[model samples]
Target: MAEPGRQEVVRRVRELLARYRDPAQVDGLGDDEPLAVLGIDSVTLITVAAELHQRWDVTIADDAVLDPEASVASLAAAAVAPGGAGDRPGGRLDVVGMGVVAPTGHGVPALWDGLLAERAHRLPMPYDAARGHRAGAVAGASAAEVVAPDRLLDLVCLAAGEALGGLDPGRRAGVTLVVGTTDTGGNALGHALAGAGDDQSALAGWVAERAAEKLGLGAAVTVGSASASGAVALGYARDLLLAGDAEEALVVGADTVSKSAFHGLAALRTLGVDGCQPFHEARRGIALSEAAAACLLRRPVPGDDAVLGRLAGYGASSFTTHMAAPESAGIELALRRALAAAALAPGDVSFVNAHGPGTKLGDVAEMRALADVFGDRVRTLPINSVKGLLWHCQGAAGVIESLACLLSLRHGTLTPTTAAEPVDPQWREFDIVTKPRELADARSAVSVSCGLGGVNTAVVWERA
Candidate 1:
């Protein structure tokens, strides 16, 4: 079913607000006036939201929007909020919770075990030639198949439930939720459970609302920037917390194979049939994949800093449209911004999670950006791409790989790229860790993402 339109959402919220108003205070009630001033309390707000949920089957995180000082109109807008979590311009956020839904398994434990074990979950393409355009190519496989948007919500719930299980539902509801996905990629995973084609883009709000409802969370938004959607969303989440809008946020990035996406790759003429050889001399191109992952972000508590990891900094850049080849300047722009935000020199980076799509242009452009960011130090850092194992997950790529980097930090393991293909003997600047390396001094790491439409994003994660 199509999601409720914007007007419908606003109208319904206002109607609920009016219904719950006290008769004594209804004399001159104004929608733009603070509801609390009109005698509305938290319980009243929750009651109205519950009624709406029962009548419309649209769950809501009422507490997040029902601030006593906020007007009825503001509450209505919050209910249907749209945008990244980082609404503010500057500030750093920390990660406190996380969820994972990848082919290797579900939950953080599965993600960690799979990466630490160095297992590849690539599988034969399930889409037929008519649908996928290619019959025998490889793709990333999840634990189960998602038949509809509702089922996709089920997968998101798995990852989110685990990450947020520790937080009180009331507290969780006060935090924002950001759902990230590319223009067309995540239709395959749990990301775009929304209907396909034109409806997909707008449905991000619908998906975010549903996911928030399931997680019992509040203010929600959707961000799409093609492949960098997840990473960009994470950046926004950080900003939202720094801006003091919410105490925490849940950011999820998911993607799956779709006819439109598969066909798009086929036309690009860079889709690899065998495997992704990221950064290798014999690299072909990206292999498609599906996955849904989530992270919980928040400002550090003064007395208790119980955090999974620290999202030190994030930067996003766009090179606009590039017809002939990928651009490196956009990546360099994001890298520089991320470094500055993190307050670290490029040389301090302990590890690198490269956005190696295995495409000739994509890989080289990323290499160039790294060289520019770290200069001579880029040659020695242990760099690797998870796409070789996880395949290209479209927008979800950033979150999935970022989680991998976090796991590496927790386990002191550096994941390996595919058995080092032929060396770029001339410019073998990158030390692609071909095998798992025990990282003793793993303090800070970086995750790189480049999307179609020239969106490049870099996020720095630090061990707290």
Candidate 2:
């Protein structure tokens, strides 16, 4: 293959930019001009990287486009240079770092505090009693505080901003933005069309456009499922990076409860009358809640502070397991698959961030699956749930829980699974952490989540 020089890289980037720019802007574009000045946001920049990767196998770092000194020539030199960091085996595949936006806290720091303190944010449902569901809210923050009015897209944007903090904007912009939501802007739009619902496609479009704008990204895409949205987002991010499509990707998972979601859960009789009580002997059902979380991912790079944990493996599976009830088989399959992909055994996991929503069946099924896969290891590994603090944020649960898992690895502490009196009789062998415990040498953690539609996703993270 012919090596590309700085001039060649510049020529390719300019061509990609031309697709979305005004003819005048395209003509005015110069090698030294900032891409943002030419209206090249993060989404468009990723498009450019995709095009370049397809044509020249060039791997651009997230900061390349944002750097003032990163001229077209310099970018080209980096892209075409043989044995460049970007061209190395691990160059295109790094977790570099992650960020979080959850109920217990806003960023990773706050999350760590909440976990260490063993705080519980679960509370009675804020909506009308007639709605028939309680929830575990993120303490003080309200939907308005976390999101813009009737703008679910804004919540995603806010989460993305928090996740990208302390990172180079130019480098961040170079990656793709993939979001996961059970209900994208449904909470806001549902209220607007209480009687007659609006077009779902239009709502989706608005969310994507607004999120892209907020993040200064070039493209915005979303994946939806009941609870597995977060896992799906990570899985997709990994795929994109591994395909050499982009050097960096931002994966965000967010969702808010509304009348629609509340009623739907109530209709299924899965709504808890009080707060959620995962693994409790007297567990009733789940309490719907709201949450948003974002993670910054890149091809692994050494010495990146943002990299709290390296994403080692991901597994997903779907089954026709009772549509209304939990499915142990599918959950176990997903967990096993993820472990296999990571080339790890069940014993390798030191902690499990269970998708405990405080529901009787849901919690039981998840525990059963854990026992099935981990066997004797289940008795030794510490396990906890963030639901007692954040409630069940639908699509956002996985990512929010992931933030908790990452914090656990970084802080060497395990958050107690609140409201869980003891390991359910059915789950006798598991070492469910009812109180916070000191975690040492905690190098690896797993996050597991199961969605309503039989979607299950598991992700393994290793200390970086």
Give per-model TM-scores.
0.73, 0.74
TM accuracy, model 1: 0.73
Candidate 1 lDDT at 191 equals 41
- Residues 260-376, model 1: lDDT tens digits: 566677787868775677877777677776677899887877766567788988877655436425677668767866776777778889999998888889888898878876788
Model 2 alpha-carbon drift over 4 Å, by segment = 1-93, 120-126, 130-132, 137-139, 142-151, 194-205, 302-306
lDDT by residue (tens digit), candidate 2, 1-464: 25536666677677776788886686686766666676566545544654565356455654664455555555565564434543332222345545555556556677778766766454445565455545545556654443233445655766778777766768656768888877745555654566544534325446655677666776677887778887898888888887778777888887766556777787888877756677888878777766678887777665655555678888776643367676776677678657766767788898999988888678878887888788777888788887765667887888878878877787788888877885578765678888888887888889998888678889988776
| Model 1 worst lDDT window (10 residues) | 130-139
lDDT of 2: 0.70
Off by over 4 Å in 1: 1-91, 129-151, 183-202, 320-324, 426-429
Total colliding residue pairs, candidate 1: 8
